[model samples]
Target: MNRNQHIWLSVFFSLALGLLLWKLKLPNLFIYSLPMYPTAILPDFIEPALDPNHRKFFHSKRMFKFLVICLVILLLLASFKSQHYFFWFFGVLGYLLHLIAESLTFKGLPN
Candidate 1:
């Protein structure tokens, strides 16, 4: 997918997550969604979309799993009220959502 498509998907995902958090009475809703926009397009920034086959290491399944693990760790750290937990949480959440969007495309992310 293109950059614009990625951004829209990210926004949709963030909104859904925000709604869920709102229902759960989670605090700092703004902080949770703040970092998503930039981080959603971060893979492209890290590995530019020069061609159709540009989804390499940074956009791979391995990286997705790594970020999932990081997300879990951030959640754990949030219990301690870590000062920067939500920043990292939303950042990784955006990256994960990006990969999910890419994986839905015809040219899915690499293994």
Candidate 2:
């Protein structure tokens, strides 16, 4: 898909995931409210970084993989701590969803 297509798809998927979470009545969903809204629109800002000539590493698949790993670690840590597992699971799921959305674009795949 093109950059614009990726952006719209990401927004749609993110919103759909958010609504699903909301309907599930998950606790601490409010904490994600701000991030979730911006997530739907983040592709606009992110597309520039995906430019092939850009030197920045933010648009790399390695970075997304690292982020996913980090989130999973956080989820694991949250599980061992006094925090709720559902919250951590949802957070990780959301992050993964974001990555998946990005993966639909050309820049999202690994080179």
Candidate 3:
């Protein structure tokens, strides 16, 4: 339940949830709009910007909760507009699973 454990758990849970969602044939859950040609690995460039230690906003629980709320609202909006809701639901569920897994590890508490 240390930092390493937390990371591993989060990764495992996320991957498992992603696999499950993929099996369910959901769409738009994993889509990203990036330039066709990338100069570097996307995560490497993105992770530091999103890293908690770097004062990233989304790294906090409050921000995460806010995100969930926003996602739910978006999902409802999509449903109202007759758009697909499967991906939204699946994506939120997967993110929540990752958060929960991280919570179970020691890293859940503030340093």
Candidate 4:
């Protein structure tokens, strides 16, 4: 997807996530979820849309898995009550959403 599409999707998903966070009584709701937008477009920034096959290292399935692992690790660390938990969590979450959005395309994601 294009940058605009990624941004809109991030906005929608971020708002949804924000609502969930609010319902769960999480603190600093906006600060946590707002990172989603930039992160959602981060892959494109790292691997620009220079060609039809621009998705590579930063946009691969392996990268998604890496993010998932990082998310899990962050959650574990967050359990210790780290103040930066939501920021990093939502950042990775946003990037994962970008890969997911790309995976829906005809090209799909690389290994």
lDDT accuracy of residue 10 in candidate 2: 52
By lDDT: ranked, best first: 1, 4, 2, 3
**TM-score of every model versus the real structure:** 0.88, 0.54, 0.43, 0.90
Query: Which residue pairs of candidate 1 clash?
Result: none
Task: State the lDDT of candidate 2 residue by residue for 53-109, as single tens digits.
Answer: 542344457766776777777667666874554455544454455556656655555
Provide the lowest-lDDT 10-residue window in model 3.
32-41
Root-mean-square deviation per candidate: 1.6, 4.4, 7.0, 1.4
lDDT of 3 by residue, 1-111 (tens): 234444465456556655665787843443411111121122223334344343234344775586579678867876787455544554555445444544465446232
The superposed Cα distance between candidate 3 and the true structure at residue 20, in angstroms, equals 11
What tens digits encode model 4's per-residue C-alpha lDDT throughout 13-89? 98887788788887476687777888999999999988879989899999989999998987777678785787788
* Per-candidate clashes, comma-separated: 0, 0, 0, 0
Candidate 3 local accuracy as lDDT? 0.47
- Greater lDDT among 1 and 3 belongs to 1
- State each model's CA lDDT, in order: 0.87, 0.55, 0.47, 0.87
lDDT of 4 at 29: 60
Worst 10 residues of 4 by lDDT: 26-35
Query: Over 4 Å off in model 1, which ranges?
Result: 81-83
Q: Kindly report which residue stretches of model 4 are placed more than 4 angstroms away from their true locations once superposed.
A: none
